[model samples]
Target: MEKERREKEEREEKERREKEGREKKKGERARRKRNREWRKRERKKGERERKIKEKKRERKKGERERERRKRERRERRKKGEREDREKEERREKGEREERERRERERERKEKERCDEGERERDRERRKRERKRGERKKAEREREESEIGEREREKGERERKIKERKKGERERERRERERRKKKEERREKGEREERERRQRGERENGREREKQ
Candidate 1:
């Protein structure tokens, strides 16, 4: 009986060890499966987060490109407006300069015309004055010639009268020689009368020349 009891206790211990080993093996296999499923879910979640980040980055890049294009367009518009304004100003300046040049030319032409007119008037006045002077000189010369001719004729007539009177006095003296004293006294008185007549005639001639 002691040996039989000892074999039965050994067999029971062996059965208990085998049962505990089987339970441990079953728990280990379950834990391994749970770990594998957790790893797979984590991988899927990581992939989804990566895709979301990529989409956000693409949207931000598009916004930046659009902003750059808008800035370029605004700058181009401002430049075009500035250029147009400058061109207009240049055109206006050219027109103003042309107007001023035309005005100056007109003033110059007017001044030339006025100067020409004044010169023409001066020439006409000088010509008239010269003609008047020539006419007066011709008149004066003609009057002097006429006066000289009249004086020469008067001198010749007086010389002829003196010669006739001398011939008459010589004839009278010869006829009265017989009446001596009376004849001499008559001759002296006649000579005195003749001298007085000659002096009066000279005085009359001098008065005429002065007049």
Candidate 2:
């Protein structure tokens, strides 16, 4: 009887030890699962930090490029301003040169006009002198011709007076010869008549004696 009871107690003790070992193994498996889940969460956090850093670096590079482009634009504007200044200076010089040329041309034209006026005045004086000399010669010729005509008229009047005096003397001599002839004829006729009358008286006395 005592050996059976001791054997039964040992068997019961062996079964309790086997059940405790199974419980320890299940606890160990649960711990291993929790560790694995924690490691996965840590890996996700690290990946997110790396992406944020890369985005910040890209933004910085874009800002630097924009600054460089602005500087280039400012340098180009300065060069254009210098070129414009040079062009303005050249235009002013050209305008001054044109003004000087126009002034010189006007002066030359004035000088030419003055010289031509002087030449015309000299020619007018020469023509006036020639006309005065021609008028003097014509007046002298007219005076000589009038004097010769007066002398010719005086000689013709003297010749006509001499012819009239000779005609008057011839007419007086013819009248005196006719008067002497008429007086001689009248005296002869009177003597003949007186002789005839005496004869007739002698005849009358003879008749008375006869009766």
RMSD from true fold, candidate 2: 92.3
Leading candidate by TM-score: 1
- Model 2 spans with C-alpha error above 4 angstroms: 1-15, 83-211
For model 1, name the residue pairs that clash.
none
Give per-residue CA lDDT, model 2, range 11-107, as digits (tens): 8887777667656645764675576567657755765686588568657865775576567656655665566567556755775676568557755
Q: What TM-score, over all chains together, does every model reach?
A: 0.44, 0.36
Candidate 1 wrong stretches, greater than 4 Å: 1-12, 110-211
RMSD list, candidates in order:
77.6, 92.3
Q: Write the residue-wise lDDT of candidate 1 on 86-129 in tens digits.
A: 76578558756875786577557656776877657755865675
| Model 1 residue 28 lDDT score | 72
